[model samples]
Target: MKNIKYDFKSVIDRHNTNSLKWDYFDDDIPMWVADMDFKVAPAITESILKRANHPVYGYTVVSDELYDSYINWWNRRYDFKMSREDMLYSIGVMPSISSMIRCLTDIGDEILIQSPVYHVFYYVVEDNNRKVVENELIYENGEYNIDFDDLDEKLSKVKMMILCNPHNPIGKIWSKEELSKIGELCCKHDVILISDEIHCDLTDPDVYYNPFEVSSDYEKAITCLSPSKSFNIAGFQSSIVHTKNSELLEIIKTQLHVDNSDSTNVFATTAVIAAYNESEEWLNQLKDEIFENKQIVKKYLKEELPIIKLVECDSTYLLWLDCSALNVPSKVLSGFLRENQGLFLSAGIDFGKSGDNFLRMNIACPQKLLKEGLGRLKAGITALTIIK
Candidate 1:
């Protein structure tokens, strides 16, 4: 057994603490939400404590340290260099994305997204009154690929498109060739490209996450990211948006103003800086735990629940489970797991129609909790089979 330096072996109860994942049910173990169960890095907690001790919790703003931290992290980790001028801060990635959507497209204009994506992208597109034009991914042989031919056709009609690299739910890290093809189609069709690279840092070191701005094909693209996902600081709501397009940047700023999503919470700036600047070692340790959890799921499913297939995940702690072999709908299966087995997993249907017989399970937790969840899952699926 490999020695893990992190405290991923112990179970920590988050119940009754306003934790979205744990507060849902008293008995149900939530392997649903993307948030993790581990305590944040020491640097992050120290930074927040230092801020909390300060006399004032007044209106806060972005600083050179905040921008510099983000810029430095990207350059240091991914070798994607950018000036402070290229980065813009927003309350959160969703807010930034929603703001950009409003600014880039007219109501009823189409926004393209690959289906079985992050469920929020669907809401951000439709809740803003824009039509959802889905180029559903092709899932076969336990792998997923973009249907670029379909995407190319879809691009002709949509005015804007959002791409999720190191994708949520599916946990796919998009390759440069694949991304360039999409960029080419978007640019050729005059579509505003929005790349959400929030899961970029969660991938293994060798896996390359191509930031849109780094590619000449995606020169006109707008990329949004945050340390929230990578650092487990989603509550801070700090996000960064970058693009070389000056006009698009101005439009995004105007929309952010209209939405009132430009300012940071008092501690967000502090959290971002601490996470990016001082927590790389912590993050590397976190990724190891995440990957270990993935292995647990893979081994458990193969040995205990042979019918369920774990998708090939390159990034993110979220594991996409293919329950198609169980011959149950995702909604029905998810509900069964919650009700019968005390296991709460995200219903795949919420992502899109392409997500049939699939469930997205959050594995960023103590190994003990993951093992418990896996046991419950086997029981639920077995019960379903008996019912049939």
Candidate 2:
């Protein structure tokens, strides 16, 4: 058997290529975007190259083999079975969510979301003229939990609910029992559930992530997933939507027509297949590296910068740093870090009202870069303390 390798020591320059994360600032280390800095798996690269070898690129239909690849992947990795008829392709999860909001609910309807979530969910709801109902997550004992009572109270008039499994920003992996309760609540309320499982594949091996529809109660849910985050293929623009309910699936299909969403890029299709079919070893290595990075951040914060507290995380390379102990506004602290430390992070307020004193850090870079960023952060905080 071949050994796994996750050597992210080599940093490849990504600037000057219209890369949003890298080109956002000059002489700044970007630890903001969710995308990783490591090279894609060799299998994905080989698949893209093989597809590129074709001289002519033309409009194409999704093949049965492509659907089979996704099906096989889900069955093997998550122990969930899906049929081809239940599958649909989209450019990405965000676009799908935006369209689904419009399709599943009418204008002026309410959409429920957990606060301090991925910011895009808020935009998707409000941009579609739907009211956003925020159920702020409860943070205690260094971990985050959903406020189900708040959610149930708010769900009284909600037409749809967006769930972030293995949530973003705080990186809490929702367990099966937790998801079962959510599924039951949604079903009781007769609300359409849009479950985003994009970060499901990047979790630590010890963590457990449950698919929403795996439970009998959540069968009416529409679950979105992709290999983009797992294999560093966000630029490829491909994702899968699974729904067992025919009526809901049809509505989503109709919305696609209304929005003129027809197809995905050819390369993205090939890349997803390769990633799901042949990148397990690489993914395992990447998960280990990410866990190591998480540990390093915890150790550095505890020993070097005890004032900064890390939120409990079990999935994704994103870390939430609580800086309320410093008693500084998050935006002001973010500015200070960017200007003095040359470090870029996603400001906490961007997520929601509950995230004001926190900052989201992306630890998906090489170790050297991670270390340098932490060092600069330590220095910057120490200087701030001295001046104060």
Candidate 3:
């Protein structure tokens, strides 16, 4: 077999494709979005092409073979076995969260979430007229941990909890012990756990991803998985909601029909099948590249820009920069980076109240671009220090 070469140095122009990362600004380097600057796997490209060759695009149902691909992939990658019957198809994790919230909980019910999480979690709860119970994560020793004591207190009123596994922004691959504690608490409180494992596949080889439902205590939970983040197929909009709870699954499916959300495009299924079936080699190479990129950021921050520190991360290509030492508001820092440094990143405040003085940088670009962005950041920080 030929070794797959994951070259992350070839910069491609993505300016005119109406991409949110590229088209949002003129002549700005977009390191804000989580999407990577890599081409889709050859397998996925070929599969889409094969499907496109069919002259007539007609209504289609998800094939059993596609479902098996997911089951097989999970078993092999995460060592978590899932039954075909337990899988439910969805457009994406966010939509599934919205639909699950609407279906499983009543209006005015409370939903719990950890602050400084994916910002959309707040909106997903509030948009459905549910109360958001914020349990802020504890940041100490350069890592973020869930406040289980506070979570226990909040669980009294919360009917559901949305968890981002291999968490966004900070890129934490939550330990099994941590997940066990959460599962025990949620089970005791009878809170429906909605674990979003969308970034599970992005983990480094040494890190472990404990699927919430993989534990017996957490079998009552629902897990959201997708090929979008791992395969760079976000535009395709394909995701799966896995659950062992038959009753909850029925409720979700029924509500999806009632809400007119029980349909998916043909391309999504095609892409998912190809991604899960034949993209492992590409994925392994991508993970290695991301790991190297992450080290580059860490080394640069520690040696070159001592004031700007990176949060601990074991997964995901996002690097959370702690700019608290700079003593500047995150938005101002973001603006300065974009205007003065030509670097764009997501402001910390956008994540939540706890994310102040932090900035999220996407390191999933070509190594050259990643280096340039880091160089600009280092230079910008140096200038700031000199001015101060």
Candidate 4:
């Protein structure tokens, strides 16, 4: 393992802390949720501590320093220049997405999403009384590719399209050309494009994901960004939306403001500023750790459980494992693993029907926990095979 300045191997006990990943299940190992089990950057904790030392916890305002932190981080890292005027603060990416769904589309309007994708894309559209049109990506030879023809056909029927760049579950990073084609199709169809890029900063070490706006000159695009996934400060509930279209921005701002999703909590701003400005090295180290965890899973899967295939991906710590060889549904397999081995991984069917043959495993934990999870997985699968 590479030497790291921060603690990534502590195996901190989260059972009684009201952690969603820990307390929600009786499973001994949870490789389910996207949040990292690693400790946050020292600077983030220090900033929060400094703020908490104050006597009062009151409503907070979004600071210019907070905006600059996001601006500088993007400019330095992705060469994506964003102005403060074009950006709007939100409590989270999902709330802002839900707000956009409510305001931008009419009842029964169709929305496009690529599958298998982040599961919430299904909820936000259907729950809002809008229809979902899936342009399922073509999966071939252990890789995922955009079906431009299908996307073009689907865009003609939808009012809006939600894109998951450096997508979750699959962990694939959409390329520049692919994003350009998507933008062109959306423009041709006059469809609104919402790019969920919260996972933009979690790529493999030295690998970078292309921001949607930077990859395409589509004016109808809204890019949702957050440091929560990258810096593991998700509990802070801070995110922002960037769009170059002033008219669309105004409409979105109004909807978010009306929905109360634009307000910030006391520590969200502090965490964002510290994460973007003072925690670059910590993020770099995290990328390395995730990379190592991926390698560990790959080696273990190949050696001990050749029945399961690890999908090839370049971004996000969430890994999509192909369990097609087991001839079992992902939901049943996931349940069996949890019941028999106390290992909880996400059932891929939750993302989309196309994902029923796969399982999504979150490997953003310490090596010790990752190894234990793998052990449980192997045990569960071995028993399942025996039953078969």
How do the predictions measure up, each by TM-score?
0.97, 0.97, 0.96, 0.99
lDDT of 2 at 381: 87
Ten consecutive residues with minimal summed lDDT in candidate 3? Answer: 1-10
Question: lDDT by residue for model 1 over 104-202, one digit each (tens)?
Answer: 889999999998999999999899999999999999899999998899899999999988987888999888788788888888899999999988889
- Report lDDT per candidate: 0.86, 0.86, 0.86, 0.94
Worst 10 residues of 1 by lDDT: 1-10
For 1-388, candidate 2 gives per-residue lDDT tens digits of 1475646778878989899899857647889989999998899999999999999898867677778988998888778899988888888889888989888789999999998999999899999999999989998877789999988888777998999987998998888888888888888898888999999987886665777777545766899988889999999888878899888888888887677664877787888888888888888888888999999999999999999999978898999999889887888888888888888888899899899889999999989889998998898888887877
Sort all candidates by TM-score, best to worst.
4, 2, 1, 3
Pairs that collide, model 1? none
Candidate 2 overall lDDT versus native: 0.86
Give candidate 4 misplaced runs (Cα > 4 Å). 1-4
- Tens-digit lDDT string for candidate 3 (231-251): 999998888888989999999
Error of 3 at 288 (Å): 0.3
Best by lDDT: 4
**Deviating ranges (above 4 Å) for candidate 2:** 4-6
- Those runs of model 1 whose alpha carbons end farther than 4 Å from true positions after fitting are 1-4
Query: Candidate 2: deviation at residue 364, Å?
Result: 0.6
Count clashing pairs, candidate 4. Answer: 0
